[model samples]
Target: MKNKKKIILIVIAVMMGIFLISGMLKGKSTVEGLVGDPKGTFVNVGKAVTTDIQTKISATGTVKAEESEIVFAEANTKVETFLVEVGDPVKKGDVLLTYDVETKEGLQRDLEKLDLQMETARIALSQLQAGSKQSIMQVQTEIASIDKNLLDVEDGIRQLETSLVIAQKDLEQVEKTYDVTKTLFDEGLAAEKELDDAEKAVMKTKDQVSSLETQVASSKKNIETITMQKSNAQYNLDLLQNKVQDETKAQNIAMKQNEIASLVLQKESVLEQLDKVEEKVLAPIDGVVSRVGAKEGSFVAPGAELMTIINPEKLVVEAEISPYYAAQLETGLTVKVKYNGSTTVETEGTISMVSPVAVQKAAQDKGAVSTAIPVKVAIDNSQGLKEGLTVDLKVVTSEVKGVVAVPLLATMTDKEDNNYLFVVEAGNTLSKRMVKQGAADNHLVQVSDIEDGDIVVTNPTEALEAGMSVSYMLLEEVGE
Candidate 1:
């Protein structure tokens, strides 16, 4: 038991010793830097004076394709065949798709029908030209025949008049016989039957004479009608002959021909439509099929989309700038672009176009975002550029020449509204000097109170105080 107690006591003592040693080690490590001097000491900063200063504004942007387009089909038709797929290179006039053969053949038939219709229209137009030469000749012949018929009618009227005169004489003789027989019968010098017979014969002769007179009158009227008709026909024939002599007839014919020509032109237009209907959709430029909106057996309406063709060779980065900065930005600005884990490249671009109106960027929601108008930057062909690359844009806004400058670290600002820095004098002693500072950048600053050859202490908090002694060190050697 005594041996166990001794061993326990020894173990407890060793534990206490280890804890104390660890605490001591941690304490020494934490406080060692505060108690001792740093392995690397002060940075000696030199005063940089004003030279030519270029003012610039920085902006971040992305690259996009300079040229892009969307294509569409012309007709609503079933897609018969798709010739090319995405990424397939095509040339101008290449067939993109062939619709169903049935539809195409129908269109061809329609075109042929249009041609036939045009021919028929031409024939109809030719017929519309009135009074051809052959028709005029036939009219003249008919008029001559009518003249002969009129002469025959006049001769028939004359003969009927002569016959009427002879009939009238015969009727007069019969009337005399009837009067004589009637006188004898009244005086009892003749038989009653003889008087009656004479009276009957006279009556029959009178009726015949009356019939002949009516025939004569009818013949005269018929002759007059035929003569007038012949005169009218002759007048028509002469008028048509005169019309043939007039230049207006030719003008009429020409006018008719012009109408036919117009119809022919209309027919030609229809034929062109037919031809266009059968024409296959062809690519206009050499490019890849960037987008496909058509498939086999799909109906494409008029101006329907088929596929998009893009030329990757003509690619550029287009950027938009705000109108507020538009006055400061001009054509031919230098730019730097970086892409795909690659090193940044120096390039210059020109302002291709600028929108007069303010255009909002993607970050804009409503009313004017920064009053920035859209501006396009044209990529300089001298630099090889690819699409879809992000770029950093820097624009020089203003420039100043020969200005005094200093390192930012060397300048100090206090609550008393004074800016100053520690300067190293000739005897290696530090002195506090008030300074006036100006515009600064990531690496350089413009200082007003320091001379060109003055030495300033960067990190003045290290051990710097007014009238303190120091050793001369080059800025390069001190790693400032």
Candidate 2:
């Protein structure tokens, strides 16, 4: 029993020793496994490469024809037949439509009426001119006759005055003789018959003087009447002279001439239309008809819309951009365009125009209004483009070639506002390097102080520090 008990204790002690050895071995194995594993943070890394990069502006645009024309009716007419329909290709000077036969007949009638009106106006103007000249001549003749009558009346007045003077002298001598006879009769030295005869002679001389005076007064009255007649005739002549040079007559002649001119213009216009009636409406440009506004057997007024044509070969893309880019947008900038949601239909283009002003537009999502500037891009190759097709555009504002560049995620900023990049060094250790950033695009940034073939950490966390070790996978190896 003592030997057995001793053997049991020995076995127990041996089991305990085995357990202690196994525990020590297990602990040592765990420590060795941990020591064999990667010792730091895991990260993805990319290489700094030399490449070409561009700063691009993105925009949505619509394809449109560069050249378009709207046709309008030149005169009032009815459509006889439409020679072409919408979407029909037409060449320059091709007949587009025809006018009704009655339209030409109406124009001819209008021309004839205009001719008649013009002829009537010309005749009236001629008559007015001839009458004006004849009236002036008649007034001149009347004035000459009045002047002659005035001269004749003046001569008569002078002659009557001379005769009256002679008769008065005779009367004075007879009165003196009568007085002498009266004295002789009173003294009884002369006969009474002689005194009576002297008195009678004196009375007869007085009557003759009175008659001469009356004749002179009558002649003076005749002179006054003749002078008044001359004045009236001269006034009439002056009126006729003024009328010949008057604005009223000139204005009447001008009115007649203007009326004739207007009638002539109307006649010419009608004749022109009549001449073109057979030729009909012609296309003004080589293009495809896009819209038709008039129908057959429909009457249209002058200046009404007829149709619209667009030249599809000359295609352009129109877009609106934010006004914030107005200063940077310019003509002749290179552009890449795509249409119809296509990826392979991209074509090169150039900016043809940029609006100098901003226009207000409603926002696509919020319905708020904002200002935008209009822009147009001329397609270099329009093989896959069509009118009114929506397109995507990327305008290259700036570009750099053969420069050291890296993924934008590889860069970081510090509390001092300094820029830096964590470059993967030998043995998977980090080396923080200061860099000056230049231009940047959506995914890559142009950087200085970084060499080509350098391995940079694409995503550096805040815990990452300089001289810290890390386990990394190459972006290319990871297929990212």
Candidate 3:
């Protein structure tokens, strides 16, 4: 029992010495310096510095011409010949192609048909005018003859009236003579034969007066008939005059004139079309032809695209950006463009437009489709840019200068949802700093309540606590 107790004491002493040596080594290792500390949690660190921080959105883009146009066919016709090919440089008004001969001939026939119709309308109008004049002259002649007959009937009635007046006086004289002869016969101083003769004379005068009155009445009737005929003829002349000036004949003339005018307009339109089909198609602008849609014998409909032209001097870069940056993307933002080719070309640009709506993009990973907004950047100098070339674009969304910033990794969130960072304090201790984050990029974040040159733990661990003693190496010294 005594020997077992002595062996137990020896083991206890050995164990105590081992524990003391381990503790001393661990204490020695925790000393702060350029070398790392083993007792403290191993972490990466960065310095809070005053520097400019820019937030950028990266995207791939395609170079495109800002001025591009597609020339189209103006009429339904077949292309007879192509005067220009793809990649051909052309000036405004230069001939690009020609139409088929059949089209020109068809237009010429249309023009000739219009001309013939117009000539026929003009001749019909002249014949209508001549007929109207002849009808008017006939009616005027009839009215003049009726007027002369009326005047002769009136003069005969006047002559008959004068003769009737003389016969009335003669009848009065004969009545007086017959009364005298009867008075003499009653006194038996005149003969009976003489009295009979006086009575017969009175009766003869009465008959003459009645006959003259009848003639005058007949003449008056004839005058009335002639006057009615003259009135009818005058009415016909007025009607004929109205017809020639403002009624059917005038309306017919107007209709013929309108027909002629309509034919004239049609002819002009057809002539213009004929001129176009006869001449070759001209370029509307100065550009390089990028595409030709028709061959020499191909038929094209009206408004069909014939070729595409692009002005290379005007260039822009088009890119698709995520909706996450929609609020930041807008016109007038600066952009950096890089074209990776046999020789990389670098240039500066500005955001010219941002689409208000979003478009669905194909699923790149065979997953759900994503949405992106299109943006255009106008290059300041397009010296080395070409149409349809793919390029890289860096859009500067936000920027700040002389601000206190730290690595994004240095920030942490507490249970209260406040942002805080582990800043290295004096004596190599950690102090939990509550900061107000202003702007953040992918790598750095702008923070308030953090001083410049404050060493901050960029890669903090879960076990890290505030006020804990730490042995740290400067991030710069560690080349991180």
Instruction: Assess each prediction's global lDDT (C-alpha) against the native.
Output: 0.64, 0.80, 0.82
What order do you get sorting by TM-score, best first?
A: 3, 2, 1
lDDT of 2 by residue, 145-261 (tens): 877877876787788778778878988898999888889889997898999899899899888888878887887787788788877766545545663456666676688888888
For residue 87, what is the lDDT in candidate 1? 83
Cα deviation at 465, candidate 3, in Å, is: 1.6
Error of 2 at 327 (Å): 3.1
> Candidate 3 — what's its lDDT?
0.82
lDDT of 3 by residue, 1-480 (tens): 225434544564566457446647777554344434445544557888898988899999999989988988876678989999988999999989888888878878888899899888887666556657776677677787887778788888888888889999999999999999999999998999999999999999999999999888888888778888887766556655663355755776788899899999989888776665644778889999989988888988768899998898889999999998899889999999999888999999999999989999778687779999999999999988889899999999889999999987777777887888898887677888899887777678999999998989876655689877765565656675
**Count of backbone clashes for each model?**
14, 0, 0
Flag regions of model 2 displaced more than 4 Å.
Answer: 1-37, 107-279, 341-344, 364-367, 474-476
Candidates, ranked, lDDT: 3, 2, 1
Task: Supply candidate 3's per-residue lDDT for 279.
Answer: 47
- CA lDDT of 281 in candidate 1? 67
**Candidate 1: which stretches are off by over 4 Å?**
1-56, 101-278, 287-289, 321-327, 342-348, 361-373, 381-385, 396-404, 408-424, 427-440, 446-453, 457-478
TM-score of every model versus the real structure: 0.45, 0.58, 0.58
* TM-score, candidate number 2: 0.58
